[model samples]
Target: MSNRSHEVEYEQMLLSRHGLWQHKGGRGKDGPMERSAYILLSRIRVQGPMSIGELSDAFGLDASTLNRQTAAAMRSGLVERIPDPAGGMARKFQITDMGARMLDEKRDYFVQALDKVMADWSDDDIAHFASYLRRFNSDIERIEGRPWPRPGTDGP
Candidate 1:
């Protein structure tokens, strides 16, 4: 087996073993907010005040699907939709202060949950894994599209 093929297979196996597919239920087969909502919030955090159409395009989802999730978020006061300041077509959605606060709280919960869940792991090991996992995510985004999660960093 070639080195590149082996590496690809290893990564695939690792992802399959631990990705959303391996959870008790299939992705979005179980979540209340729907995975679409999560992606919307994440993109909103990164991109800021994007129109629904743009979000739909970025995630390869349809406007209806995106609108459904955005509607739910709006009802919950997690997002706010406003007229596009520049005026053109689609209205823009922005995360509210409440939404940002919720994201931060969720992060803290994740940290605590992982710490308790991995109580036996050494601090150094955990830190290393966290850093590498973050880098891996960043690299995958670059591979899939371009330098994102840090816009415009991809060199010439």
Candidate 2:
């Protein structure tokens, strides 16, 4: 591996060891959504309804995997399948009202947790860190050809 690759690998390993991404279930109205559900709902929330094919293209995942994830989300009342508004043959998934509320709650919880973790960091430092993260993610997305949508812009 190159020098930068080695450094990135070490940092990523340390981040994993920190256990910050571990699921903290059992909270909110539905006991907190799963990570997959949270991400899938977030995409739908931002981009409106999306068919399975669209999701597969966006996430670079196969239909079977998306099927399972969407099924679980539907069972959890987080998303529902509706006919494509554009008259397409395949149905699209849309976030439900409950899903929206739960997404908001879950997002708030995550923001609060991050704020607590960064309590000692200065505002400028945090901003710089955020900028770096966005750049990093955007570069990866560019390489993968699967850019994500973001608020206040056409896409992330």
Candidate 3:
């Protein structure tokens, strides 16, 4: 198939997966957290506390939208706002212990679901697929000029 055709197929698959994840209780909650909430909590956990402006840039979202989202998270006790640890003027959001526990649970659930889906695949095949997926995400981040902090690396 042509590269363009393959890209279209890939996009379709991604949309399908997203739909399933969002609507099918794939996050292990009958009413899963909003996608934005999950991503925001996950990012804060991985990259440490971050300001709304910084998150806006990273997620390509407006500060006001993030403000509302963070407010909701705060109300839920999933995150807390504090002075920037780096001594910046703007406050940053940090995930709470409850948030971390929830994130870990959701991650485990997702992994279990993936294991079931890929049960027939060999270890080498799984590793290769993971490598390519990471590369794809990295390339997109590079193009967007907002690279995500990779785990186990000293990130800027």
Best by TM-score: 2
> What lDDT score is found at residue 132 in candidate 2?
89
State how far residue 119 of model 2 sits from its true place (Å).
1.0
- Clashes counted in candidate 3 amount to 0
TM-score-better candidate, 1 vs 3: 3
Q: Write the per-residue lDDT of candidate 2 for residues 1-156, one digit (tens) a residue.
A: 799999998997887686544646225777657888889999998898999999999889999999999999999899999999999899999999999999998888778878999999999999999998888888999999999887777754
Q: Ten-residue segment with the worst summed lDDT in candidate 2?
A: 18-27
Clashes of each: 0, 0, 0
lDDT of 3 by residue, 22-129 (tens): 544444442356667888998888799999999999898999999999998888778899999989899999998877877777777678778988999999999998
Give the whole-model CA lDDT for all candidates, comma-separated: 0.68, 0.87, 0.82
Model 3: lDDT equals 0.82
TM-score of each: 0.63, 0.91, 0.86
Clashes of 1: 0
After superposing candidate 3 on the true structure, give the runs of residues whose Cα lies further than 4 Å from its correct spot.
1-20, 23-31
Candidate 3's TM-score reads 0.86
Clashing pairs in 1: none
Best by lDDT: 2
